[model samples]
Target: MVLVISVTVSFFWLWFIKRFETSTRLTGKPSVIFSLFLCGIGSVFAALFLAELEELLLSHVAFLSPLTYYVFYVGLCEEFGKFLVFYLAASLTDMTKEPKDGLLQAAAVALGFAILENILYSDWGLGILLLRSVMATTGHMSFAVIWGYAAGLYLYSKRAGKNKYSFGMVIGAVCTAAVFHGLYDYFLGMDLKPISFLLDAIVLSISVYILRSLKGRSPYESGDKEAVAEAIESNSNNFHLNRLAGVQALKTRDFETAAKYFKKASTVNHREISTKVCLLFTELLTGSVEEFEAYRTLDRICSSINVSNLNRLRARIAEVFAGCPDEERLLNLIDDLIDETGYRELLKERIAQFDKYANAIAGKGCADSGFLISDKNSLPMAYRHPSFYTKENNE
Candidate 1:
């Protein structure tokens, strides 16, 4: 009954957190479920680990102060384990960009842990439930949310290529989260007399306030006209070139440049341009989650289109391109796209080429999302037209 009550309290808090963050880009169900699973597993591991430490404490190891013992045995090990769980869950999933997704996942896991811990303590009464809800449960959620939000930020901001600095930042964030978790636990464990809970409440409140303040308008604000104009021009110039150069780049396996050129071309306000280029580029360049930002930017650019059917069709195609790798998957996706876009003949021809290319690449779908990398090829200016890649290249 106590476990149930604890879970109930957690559920309400989770609901409230989700509700509050709905307007933000962080939202998803899969992430939440997976995070809870991680928490459940992590809690079991933590309990076992803590039990061993308790045994050590009872046995009396020489020169081991309570603070020193707690730091290594309780604080560091358990907190680090929880962060590890968060990272593991993220690395395995595709919804990595769903912003506050990490927070939800972490909170769920912590809540699951809290529920189990409450049950173990035999404090299933409403009073204990209420107490845990106000203090322990809230503490778990707050710490997890802090770590999760930082993970989300790191994941979102991370770019491709092996940079030591980038890798370090990710590692650093995880470690810092562990430190924060440790400090919280350590302070709670300390004999702070009557003011301990008050201190905790103040700390949690202050941390939350800081995090909320950290969120505001992005530097990549959607309303920036000058930046948008420059982006349009840059994309147009890149697009107004030959398809073979981009294709050759793919063949040579220079996916990053290929993605850049393809993206450049796709950005132009050109109706003659096939959204397929963007879709294909995204598929080839799927390694970087930053591609989602590009996709979102492209989507925003297309918001003015009268062709809702085409727009939705292309958007769905981009999504599939982001996830699937199998040639069969691409074929099925293309067929669905054609059916939706009412581009039967154009799509059929494209499909034939797509199939041939798929066969040639031998089931090598987009390298990252749909960006393919290869050696640079000299693409003639005349090849810029959408018709060029469709007709001449097939020959």
Candidate 2:
């Protein structure tokens, strides 16, 4: 009966954590489940190894405080064991592509550890089993979420090409989880009800906050249904994969294919301004001025578009206009900018510079004399009139 009760409670907690995986569409992979079980079995061995090490090392010490033992020996050992498995699973598996996946997989690992732990304590009676189910199992899950969120953030950052701080984030997450686990154990070992309750409350609050924040930033939450269907047809719903495809197409100068992928990505999440920008840029490169103009105008009108994105769009427009002499389109884009937002001053300065360059080229009758001339060192090579250089050579 005791074994039945223990197994039932363990499975229930596993089910609870697995729900997160299902919601994130991670349940389709059998490898992920297999990894979780391996981590669980590895955690059992880790526990045994740590016990032997602790017994050998602590026996040499003259005196050891209970708090020190709980924090360093018990807390550090257990948390490190779980973390090793978590890190291995994350590194080895292609399944952990998103932040939510990290959280789900970490939780799965924690559940596995908790199940083995529960089995070990099964003979402690029903009261202990019930207590462990509610406190220890939940505590393990909560602690894993902290580091899991960090791992997820690292993965997300790497995918976005902004991974400068990813290593720090991972380290900070692991340390923070270890400390929290240590404190929880220390407080519980002290046998003070009030202190333990206070620590539990803090841990629980942090876990809830982390989960909510990760959900809000989840990439799975965005994208159109049709786009998702297409991704499914292609056997991938990974946002990074789609974005990489678009990037590759762009690099190959296949503007149409790039535009197709970018458009699909834009539909994935309407709020992803960067994807929209890529689509708009692709349209500009393809000489689809009309499409570019429409997207620009719509982006300008949408209040949800922030100032930073507005500036990026303006810069891209400037680059395009500088490279190609399209007076009418340039005038229209400038007029739209003037009427739309607070970027009038910046636009005016850019126009002034462009006009100055054009005048210098026309007045000098020299291809190499003006700022409009393309130089290997200069970027977004300023616009040169197609005929200006030809006329200069004739003169």
**What TM-score, computed on C-alpha atoms, does each candidate reach?**
0.47, 0.55
Model 1 misses residue 259 by how many Å? 17
What does the lDDT read for residue 363 in candidate 1?
Answer: 39
**Superposed model 2: Cα runs more than 4 Å off:** 2-5, 22-34, 54-59, 156-162, 166-168, 223-258, 262-395
lDDT of each: 0.50, 0.62
Per residue, candidate 1 scores C-alpha lDDT tens digits across 262-379 of 6555554345334444435444455654544544444454333434555555564444344334435444444443443343346456545644554555434534323252411222
lDDT of 2 by residue, 1-395 (tens): 65566557656766665555533353234537536855865776786687688879778788878777776777667776777777776666555555666776777777778778877887888877777766777787778778877786676456545573467777777677777777887877677757776776778688777767656654444433333333334334544446546665665577787788777767765666656656666676678857557545554544454446566765654543343334355435544544444443344455566656655555443344334434322433333332222222434
After superposing candidate 1 on the true structure, give the runs of residues whose Cα lies further than 4 Å from its correct spot: 1-4, 20-42, 50-60, 98-100, 123-130, 159-194, 210-395
Using TM-score, give the best candidate's number. Answer: 2
Model 2 TM-score is: 0.55
